[model samples]
Target: IQLRAMIRWGLETVHRSLAPWCSVDSIARHLVEQTESLLLQLSDVRPLAPNKSALNHLLATAGWLTPPLVDGLQALGWLIDERGLAGTAATDGLAWCLPMHELFERWVEHLVRLWAYPFGGHVRSGRTFETLVPIRWSSAAPKSLKSLVPDVVVELGSQTWVFDAKYKNHFEELDDQAWFELAEEIQSEHRHDMHQALAYAATCPASQIITVLVYPMRLPVWERLTARGRSVTVAEVLGGDRSVQVALAGVPIQLSHPEQTNQIVAAWNPLFSVGQ
Candidate 1:
């Protein structure tokens, strides 16, 4: 229900902005036409065997496609073309529309603020909250790192958290070789995340540096990693429900629904208060 309402609101908002130049119905019709055309073009080409010309055409049509959105759409297209779209995995894979997903997430947060208990008697938004807040690691770095900008960064508060968002299908099980390879890959990535977060925390002495791995909840096991006194926590969040399964130091909690996230924020408030 909330998702549908958000989609409608997004369409309405777009229509309103363009209303002065065109009628709402006309604007909507044009959007539909464009989307259908794009889908048709996309349908003809398999991403694995994508022809350069076809990719160019699709790209030209999707002018508003941001990097993350492009990544998401390509990921979805791959999943659909390879795996028949008829299961929990497919449903979860289709839920990656980038900024649209982000909008829905924020909406959930808004609903939580209105209906749920406050995280710390004050719901943090914008740059006020530790996780949402941005920090500059190198004083001389060309630009201040922004969360919206999208790159690996450690969020510092009472504890230092290294955070990254993985938008991929979850694994149910793996054989021994696959398990070893997977573990090695994750360990390397986790170490890199830790180094970056630790670098950020060096500037802020009071904070304890921690690392977190955030992946779709379908993946099993949330393990803890410790190297040289730094801690890394791995958590699995449900892709469909967006419910957070684990919370760890050195990681920002990314939830599927805002209401559920608000509950998480409320839970974290006490820890924050005591740590502060």
Candidate 2:
């Protein structure tokens, strides 16, 4: 119940923060999608029986509860309503809408709290790097290459770590060809992403370049790979365990979805740290 409340609070905060830039409808829809995903993931984990008193309290003053969870419930209710109103224009059609800056920012925050930092002690002082910073990577030459965007970027001591979010089931060992292909693709598009991070390391010249990939637990044991003199550590974020923390280049990277995050962070951490 406490965990649910905390999750609800985090979501509501995100919704409120994003409401200024995006419509309540759009935000509600996004929240609903995320909530459904979360619920589906948790379906296997037995939910603690709802406390009757708490249920009554929630029902009486649903408004008083945090906005994200309230918005989530509202979104769920809206989905139910939409199903009833199917075939009517009242239901918003599926569209790939560009998320507003505020919405994106809030989403990032929610992700950090709900997916990145689930363990209490992983983040010291409960601080996370701001999401609105104007960090840009050099344009990639090969247009076909996909530039990776890490979920969280952490600066620890003199190093900056890029943590990418991968919401996959688990980490699989990549063969040499696979790693080479991925590295080749990354180098082709955003040639400077790694270099820029290394340059940024001048100020905090990271001892390591970390990429934290977020993956769902319940697959296999996390694997660690070292290739081209770079190290990649794959860690698992079990669905049942909420508090999981791993270190990349000495910086603590915590994730609610540890399996994926660990792989990402591990892959990038060594790039900057090896020779430093």
Q: How accurate locally, in lDDT, is each candidate? A: 0.37, 0.38
Q: For model 2, what is the error of residue 244's alpha carbon versus the real structure, in angstroms, after optimal superposition? A: 23
- Total backbone clashes of model 1? 9
**Per-residue lDDT of 224-276 in model 2, one digit per residue for the tens?**
23334233443322343121223222111233343444444344433334324
lDDT tens digits, residues 1-276, model 1? 322232233333333333342321243457655544544544433324233454446556878878975654454344334432222233343453556435433433443344223332323343234444355477677765564322233333444333333332222222123546676665566456445543443443333432233333221121121122122233443343222223233212343332343333343332233324
Q: What's the alpha carbon RMSD for model 1?
A: 16.0
Q: Model 2 Cα displacement at 33 (Å)?
A: 18
Error of 2 at 212 (Å): 5.1
lDDT of 2 at 95: 36
Q: List where candidate 1 sits over 4 angstroms from the true fold.
A: 1-182, 205-213, 219-259, 266-276
TM-score of each: 0.30, 0.29
Q: Give the clashing pairs for model 1.
A: 108-258, 109-258, 119-266, 160-250, 161-250, 161-251, 162-250, 217-237, 242-256
